[model samples]
Target: MQIISQVFQEISPADFFYRNKEIAGFSNPARAIFSAIRELIENSLDATEPFGILPDIYIRLSSTGETEEEGFYTLRVEDNGSGIPSEYIPLAFCQFLFSSKYKLKQTRGTFGLGGTMTILYGQITTNKPVEVLSSTGDSKIYGYRLMIDIERNQPIILEKKVYENDGQWHGTIVEVNLEGDYSKAKPKVIEYLKQTAIANPYANIMFVDPKGRLYKFERTVSVLPPQPKETLPHPHGVDVETIYRIIRVTKCKTLLDFMQEHFHRVGRQIAKSFLEFAGFPEDTDPKRLKPEEIVKLVQAMKSFNGFLPPDASCLSPLGEEILKAGIMKELEPEFAAVTQRKPSAYSGHPFIVEVGVAYGGKVPVRSDNDITLYRFANKIPLVYDESGDVSWKVIKSIDWRRYNVEPGMPIAIIVHICSTKIPWKTVGKEMIADRPEISREILNGVREVARKLKVYLSRKEKVKREKERLSVFLRYLPKIAEFSAKLAREEKVPDIKNLLRRVRRFGEG
Candidate 1:
């Protein structure tokens, strides 16, 4: 056997802290696109909250140069909402892997890692810089602009420009250059923009191509999504290491007090239950417990009953109305519906789901092309490849042929789910838990909407068929008139054609 000491060789700092440096350094182009878009979206959502304005967001896409590898694409996203404070510019724009927004409840970005990754992605792809223009309510602009190095994972401050625009400045504009074949990624970029417009019906968006083509999406509603709530950590969720550290370091007399100080959502009811079950009084000195007693108490704490479920007070979600409006805007449909599932308790925390679907018309149901499927855990859209997402999986399993949707006809569908613990499959946040319970909930909710859609389509088809039959009968009227004229001229046939003409005229009349 190898020596125990040999296995514990010296390790470098870079080895542990810079893990996944490539991904952290510069992500793939498609992922970068996803990242960039996500950053702009997050900023827009932030602006729309609090003041309760239906968000007005704009996305513009343009390509420079003709050659594939030599070509360049720029995506510009602008949002007219609550702008960032001038003082927070450095922390909001330049900092890497840092987030000022964090709460215990369901939020889109708990880690605050997404936005920086976007700038990093652009830096890696272009080896250049990114520009930003942000302003608060009628305040002078404080733009903390910079260029990032992908290889070194460093930010280089470029220029800090003062604002000169005359209008009330309450928005931000972000522009970035990245190496991409815009021709290839154009469809996807457009689809994403349109879907975003639909999902955020309260937000107005506009896109202009490099060739001078423009696409604009405006919100029809006046309502904005709800603001996010703060969350608290679960007491039971703390590991053994955490509890041991707390017991050793805390000055509290009882375990209940320690729980209250360190853990969140832990009320007196739960503390009393944990103490009673552990055979400890509320006032028992935590320092007095022997090792055996501690073990017993820990076990009892684990088995404690009637612990209040995790409160969803901190969970924030964009309301169903707004989410549906945004979806229907891009995936225009004859029938569109949204369903928000009741809050569900999981591991003592409450979670919920909001699903939206649009049936009829062409929403491009093609396997070769990535279908415009949008998923938001809370209110943030997952921007990675959606081929293997839960919604895509459900789409693949469903029999679309029955709906008379020819192979690649457009069929738009959008889904959003909110929970304290999202079973996200990747850092890209593209896939969700494939477990039976989650899958079952998603499938059932979508199927109900699909059922209603199928009925609507079938009725429409029936109306179309009836119209065609009536048109065919109308086409015979002229021929019948000619025959009647011939019979009248022949006379020997007793003018049968005349009789037929009369009958045809009566029918026409």
Candidate 2:
């Protein structure tokens, strides 16, 4: 045998994703199908909700080549949203890292990596082209059939078409073919869609599974959460690299203007004071800062105490009212308590935590655990890796029994973390990192709702005791009334029914 030497070469983003697909949650056929559906739905949600459009998303999974190709499937997702422009269709669907989500905002995306990974994974698995059709409420409908050249990270368009539009329809539709084990992925895919419905009760989602079963999650609320606003980066969050990138494109000349323009809540005075504290000249050219000087600036910025904390304007948290409404509609829990924690920050990135507790009614009970914990980041459901999640860690540490909750009870807990940057444990975004600040907030929020649940449980227990007492009295009170009437010899029961009505009213109240 002849030995060969190793060679080094640069690889494109598409090629890297193709070789290391598991990093994007496409480890196997089952998971690939699930991830594909999830990515498209999330993309649709970002498009519609942020733009003030009530979303109507449709998904269909059908068999494509069942006999000839093992487990081959066709996945189609359509959304009534702000459609993409004709010129941007190729870049939006095929290009890697080309996105509007690279800024400081709360969105369910990863710099456009998630959607492209889905497209690339499908192309590789089935060797098939993708079809996309869209209209942005304009009078032109554009359609394209394309495939990605994985080696070069470019789109190879196979066909393009233009059609007459009625101007009444506005949305996008994407269809792709791939290999998947729908039977195996059914449970997870259904759970994801259900969880998504719980989080976004204002959106209507209809799904058709591979076996032609229909699942519908209809809107239970009429209002949507406030849209998240794009914000400036904070000084505490920036590093030398972040500064360098901004400086490359920034229009500001001097460092003083640069700080005030690029960082959140930085004023002219604060900028000057910070420069003085960092020992850098205030009039230094921002674009000309040396590497060593920029490093010092970053270190000084973190140590400075004059900067104000970041605000929650960049986060869109679901209000307690909306959360409770959704829980009631979906889980039908007899008791529910939800709390939207006040805004907090870490690494200069503002975040908010929302915790909800529900018990009894239709909430499923597991004989072994009897708990259903739903975790989310930036409104996207995290359906895997729960044991290592930050929220779950905080939950396990809490004394839930103090709040009249325990194992083997029909209970569900939802923890939602919305921030411009979620500290995820992995690149797949399945779990949250156990940051002290974020952990403390989760603990506090969960405890707040647990206290409310305790009150509800106490009242419910009192009502149950009252009902039992009323039952016993109703059984024996009639005998006492009959005996008294016979002894008095006047025969009428003396309207004992009125007394029973009063007792019932008192017991109920």
CA lDDT of each prediction against the hidden true structure: 0.63, 0.88
Per the 3 Å backbone cut-off, how many clashing residue pairs does candidate 2 have? 0
* Candidate 2 per-residue C-alpha lDDT over 162-270 given as tens digits, one digit per residue, 9 for 90 to 100: 9888866788999988888888888899989988988898999999987789999999888999988889998899888888889899999898899899899999999
Candidate 2 residue spans exceeding 4 A from truth? 1-5, 67-69, 476-506
Error of 1 at 34 (Å): 4.6
lDDT of 1 by residue, 1-509 (tens): 78566455553322222344344322445445545666667667666654576667777656654644565667687877767776665555545555656545665654555666666555655666678878876748766667744334455677788877578767877877765545555666676676566656666767676677888777688766665466555654444565676678779877778656666666777777777766787887777877777677656655666565566566665567776666566666767778876655544445666777676554656576433466666666665557667767876777765655445445566777777667777655657766555566677777776676677777777777766655665576556656776877853323345655655555444
Model 1 TM-score relative to the real fold: 0.74
What would the TM-scores of all predictions be?
0.74, 0.93
